[model samples]
Target: MTSYYTIDHLPGRTIQLDGQDYLFFSGTSYLGMAQHPAFQALLAEGMARYGTMFGSSRNGNLQLNIYGEAEAQLAAFARAEAALTLSSGMLAGQAVVNWLKAQGFGFIYGPKAHPAIWQDPSTSLPTVSFTDWTDQLPELVAAAATPNVVIALNSLDALCSVDYSFDWVNRLPDGQEVTLLVDDSHGFGVIGPEGSGVGALIPRRANVRLIVTASLAKAMGMPGGVIFADPETLRAIRHTAFFGACSPIPPAYLHAFGRAQALYRTAFERLQTNIARFENRIGLSDRFQHIPAYPVFYTEQDQLYSYLLANRILIYSFAYPTPADKPNTRIVISALHQPEDIEQLGDCLYGKTG
Candidate 1:
């Protein structure tokens, strides 16, 4: 029988697991704002004002104003025309896919596309891999039976730590238009200025329409998923049956979300500092591409994983994309981790101690 260890306190860089404190490096809380006192205070204020749960459908007559406020703030932060929040990133991805299918758009998914984007194969239309799609993009666009075609991919792959630069947008054949649907969950709140994500790195173009979906639960240290798009696209998505049918995220989180923007900005700077320190201490190899803001480090060796775990460091060890093969151990760094903690980890990895 598989046994699970019990967590005794709130999660931070250090966590109490089964009565023992361990340095944790397996969480998605990149900015480490989940346990921030100020953020927690905002959460408490939200709870006091809105209670624990709204427990109502988004399309219902009774809707919280905080939801609109939070979305507006999110849009402003992301520099998008509009933003929408849902219960989870998976649900948000499904809703977008459903809307795209309804509009008769065929999909070309990247090699390392998230499973959430293509979960329901039955609804997917003329879906193809990125390589295949790239090889036949011009033909596909010219002879597309649908109104539009979409290239769906992640902004960054956690396992490989590679940023999908979306350079193909510029290389598209003249007179061909394709929508770019990106899941920026890994990049959001970690990369770009003020944590605006991959969209900040890539400028918008007239020929391409950019749609981004992300989960706030990671770096923002908040719950729910967010979609950033133009006002017209948002209006259309809001009217979708899936969007209206699903229950909205908690009002407390929405309220806290609006109030936590400044905090997120502050945390982002510290996180960047921590990342720089880590990189400086442990020199990265040129063999693998690295994103400074992304804390995950992937290695194929199991000895390193075992050594870290033996020293009470809990890092993520699993397979790439899935748990079938190609084992990868992921070591995550966060702003919550102290400089000494980073130094200690560096020592362990590089055998350097003073």
Candidate 2:
């Protein structure tokens, strides 16, 4: 039988459920900035400077400049020509899809692409057959007659246990230009130098146009979504009805985001250290390419969920944003997790007696 519990109280890495504290390993706040006093101070200061909400639409004549400032800062961090911020990462993905559809671009979706990219059933655009591997992408692109073809995928697919490599960018047949739309939601603020996302790992190429979108709510411990693209692309998107009609992210949050750069960098280092220790204790194989920021273990034989819960550890177990047939046990290690917590969880997973 399945049982349910609620978090009555939360204190950083630990949660109170059933009047007992349990170490949490299921949340996406990878850098642990959500509970940082310093980060909270910045948010409070922002709230003081800017009101709690900027309820006005972006299309309004009078608007706050904090939104533009935040977008510029994010663009510089992502090393892109320009950036746009939306209320949520899902909206950011939808904005991109809407732009592509408006531009008459056909899509070649990756097998493990996030549902947000193709969740809209009302879309009338054409889609090529889903390609499960990089080797099959070029032929599909070559066959498409559309002026622009988009290859949509996730930078790190934890569900399939695959980390995309840039080598595939070189394999695309010459003269067949394809745009890459990557949803790096899981990798942002977790991987790459200074948590710049997967774009930092892949060398920039002149042959392909790269566009990436991610949710700041994840590792960044902030709300909203950001899009990185060229100036022309961003400008075109900005002029769309979606951008003009939607409300901008709260001014105070954007102000806080602009000021939390240094904190994010510091937290990233600590998170990496915790990941390394956990991986060492668990003895992970080299073949597993999922990002260290997201420590997901795949097992069909072991009852690890019940085992961990019995030990007062909470983890996320579900098949979501992935094929329903394939489920994964996700253990998210954050910077807030203590060394002993990591060791204890590692010991539990490996059945090691300490």
Candidate 3:
């Protein structure tokens, strides 16, 4: 069985548990926006103006203007023709999948694609490696009898600490019209130019339609999910019952997200510096598998999990998505960590004490 623990407060550079303090090195907070004082203050100001929550549907007569304003900013930032916001990233994924299902398109999923983008909840994900899957994608799509197909995948696989390329989209046979759906939940505020995510970098073509979905909660520190697509497709999706019936993301979050752009840039730079510093300290070793400029460092060294715990250092080590999956052990670097914290973590990884 996997172990579990609880903490009373939000984790930053460190976490406190059972009267003990440990250097925290887990979670998807790449930009460290959650614990940022300026960001928090912006959120507080937002709450003061918008209140805690808005329970009505977005389609209701009384609408908060912040929703449209923030979404416009998001669309501009992502370079998408249009954008839509939902209560959660899962809901955003489901809404897009549900819409695609109604259009009668066949689905092809990437190996590490999140369950959020799955067409059917009970369907199992492929057990093959990502490279293997990519190699077979063109042949697989060419063989499918369906006229329309949707290829769903993640912008990058965070659990495995691997970044993916969309060059395969160009290799697929032209017989079927393709809609590329990317779940950028992990990459939204950490990857790509200006931390805009992979939406802008994905190659565009005449016949291929692109849709990018992300949870802003990860690095953006907003309690919401966003969808980016062409204007016509976005209009159709907006009309869906899934979009109409669901509660929208808290207006306060949108309020803060719109005003904290500069703060986000600073955090991204800090996170990059921290990742570089940590990598330099650790150097190249078989003990870790990671990508340059990425924040996660994955490892199969299960013993290190316990060893770090004994030394008051914490990282992710557990069965992810389900109990049947491999224990998702990784060290997550974040912008909140300082030079001293990085040094301490490096010492712990080397089996040395303060």
Candidate 4:
């Protein structure tokens, strides 16, 4: 079939996989409440009050107080100086790249950096490709014989696992003025000990300026992406053609963020515990097959994804049309997930196949 539905032949929570309806386990829904009652309630309230789309930039007549509140909480939550709510997380990436280009900075990227970070910037930066950016980063930069570097980080990638004694952000080349941008798309609210972004987990490293951006689509279990940075930088982008020209979010999404912030801390602790449980019960200790995160164990992962789908279970998988090589399949634990769900997924992954 040219098009597909959920594995269970439903929408949202379910999507078609391998010719059968299955709970979509292959997307980033860390809190797993795409259909939560509160979400619905807020959505209805927003529809009644603010309509579906904001229809203009936040600077327009509709200075959505809800959107502003979400931005504030997001900045506070990310523990950054400030935040800007983008229509999407990916949009955040696009905006950032544009900003860097305007700054007239040359960029060098980690091997596994997200496509949005460097690939599209090919027209721009003096690029360097490395097998393992963590190991080759300094050497490659030293060899490049250039300065004015911008390092884009996707924390889940293996290149940045342990977070070291502190973080790689600090270990950046000593005399170079580095602009370290971390797209904590996967790490926000999910990996850190607190619901705070991963930036909070690691001690601030030297000359290690941070700019984090993430989609609320995943761990926030809602739609849209929020970009966090200092207020000055964010404000400067406000009038830029890219950001200033676009419509803002619907009131419904704004409401969703308020609800997410209220519940985020509790959900974080629950998911962390579940990760601990998955590791403890299976008698296995490892990181995700492709990315670096807590208790996302395994490798050679297609078999695991297939097994999960066949049993009517689901998780995020970066298989198929998205990218053929990266085994992006993932099981996102949620506050809504029961302890039993964890057991079942663990058993399926760890159980002996006779």
Candidate 5:
């Protein structure tokens, strides 16, 4: 069994373990907003105005204007007709799944999908690879009794650092009302031309409806989730008990998010620079699997994980979500990494000291 280590503080460029500091190259803080000075200042400003938390139901008699304003800003940012914010990304996904089930849409889950979008814990999904699943989707959709279908999948497999292509949507047969229920949790603030995620890049069809749900906690560094959809679709979801009964994300975070657009842009630029520098240092190597412009790099060598740790560097190396799952090892880069940090990591990677 793999034993776990404990940490007492938020992880940044470095982390302390056993009274020793190690270069921390693991985590989902892709944009490094959590430790960013300017962003933190904005967050402080928001808290000063909105306080720490807002526990009131969104449908309560008293409503905060920040929620609607943030939603509108998010919708505009994502290029969607409308967007809904939730307390967590998991809630956003479950809300969408519940709505899909109520509409009687049969599900076809894609590869390595996160559990957040599942109909339930026991819902059995195809065990085949993503390519095989896509190859068989057309036939399955054509044979189904009902035309309403929901394809639930992650935009990318973050554990393995694989970027899934959306070209498969173009091959789906017409006449079927297909809803692409994508969990863009990993891609939301990291990829796409404007950092809007994979939703805008998916192929659009007359019969296809695109619905994207994401956790803003990752790259966006917000303690919330969001659902992006067409105006009618979003309105229907908004009316659900799930939306009204649940408490919204802290008004303070949304307040900061609404005004931090330029800050996000600056962070993204820094992140891109870090990625380029690291890629140049690592070069082309078969020991790792990676996607261009993405922050995470995956490897199958457990020995490498141990090696990095021995060098006083820490990277992701553990089973995810469950202990039964295969262990994953990934080196995550972020905007918080200074050029010197990258150089030190490169030295360690090349078996150099100092």
Candidate 6:
């Protein structure tokens, strides 16, 4: 019965929950820019200029200016050659899957493929769940039913527990034009040498074509999603139903996006400090046992979720079961969270299973 609460404050890591406010270590507002005055002003100004809803595709409104600039800003921010903004992260994911399917290619995803990947209707492709992308060669070789293999993965919070290294990605079998769709929603502004997060992982590779997509709700603390890749691939994806049929995002949002993308590079160190501080303080070394992803605290999720809710503290739980994998929950962390919030969350979990 732990319901989510919203605050008048911008979408930062920490905020009010019900009448009680806690340092929000949850959700994807990794760098705390969501609540920054500049970011907030961008949204406010955009709203004043363009109103809330565009309500139509590029056809009627021709608001391509906002889109193009945002795409450019995001590409530079994400270190991608180009980018596409989608209505939602899930839609962006579905867009790629649908497009790949329509092209008659096979996709072998990590064992923990986001549920939407499997929901795709394209049947001519092969889809496999990879538990360990680097070590699961036998599984992939045995499972792949087609020559073309497309892999959709999250860099840090991988659906599978794959390491975020170009080394393994380079090890990908040759002669196959394997398109790698990496979801860096969580890593975009928080990790890596430059706070480029997952982008820090890609520049080293030459063999594979890479595509990055993510939801702004998580890290940049916005409400939409971004697709990053080359212009040709982006052009190809734009023709899909999810990309073409849907209405464009409001022009006002471009401000938040622009500010977030601008700040992501500078804010990486602060976010990393926040991450390291929280990790050092907590002693979950004894109680939790699930695949590790960034600063997320994962374990027997369902029961932990119910237990924490009954106790009044709230958290998100991830529970996609892989092949031969048992269900679990993940406790996602954010940069805006204060030291106190981590202590409270630690007490909650430590008290439960410890």
Tell me the tens digit of each residue's lDDT in model 5 across 150-244: 88999988888887888989999997889999999999988887687887889899999999999999999999999999989988888899888
What is candidate 4's TM-score against the reference?
Answer: 0.80
Worst lDDT window (10 residues) for model 4?
1-10
Q: For residues 12-98, what per-residue lDDT tens digits would candidate 6 score against the true structure?
A: 554565666544434555566666677778788888877886777754435557878888987877677898887777777777777
Which parts of model 5 have CA positions greater than 4 angstroms off?
1-3, 352-354
Model 2: worst 10 consecutive residues (lDDT sum): 123-132
Candidate 3 lDDT, tens digit per residue, 1-354? 346898889999899989988999999888989899999999999999999999998888888899899999998777678899999999999999999999898998888789889999776778898889989998888876688989899999898789898887778776668899999999988888888889878888777899999998899988889999988998899899989999999999999999998998899999999999989888887889898889999998877788888889889999877888779889999999999889888887774544
Q: Which digits, one per residue and each the tens of the lDDT, describe model 1 over residues 1-354?
A: 112355757778887766777788777899887889888899999999989888888888877788888999988888777899998887787788889878778776666777657735543433554456556656656676655777777887777665555556666655656777888888888876778887876656787788889888898887789898888888898999899989777788888878887888878888888878878876765523466666777665656667886787777666654557766667788879888888878777777856
TM-score of 2: 0.90
Model 2 alpha-carbon drift over 4 Å, by segment: 122-132, 284-294, 319-327, 351-354
Candidate rank order under lDDT: 3, 5, 1, 2, 6, 4
What is the TM-score (0 to 1) of candidate 3? Answer: 0.96
lDDT of 3 at 274: 98
Residue pairs in steric clash, candidate 6? 14-24, 28-218, 110-130, 111-129, 111-130
Evaluation by lDDT, superior candidate among 1 and 6: 1
Q: Return the lDDT, model 3, position 350.
A: 76
- Work out the TM-score per prediction: 0.90, 0.90, 0.96, 0.80, 0.96, 0.77
- The list of candidate 4 runs beyond 4 A from truth reads 1-24, 119-132, 139-147, 158-166, 202-206, 285-295, 308-310, 315-330, 349-354
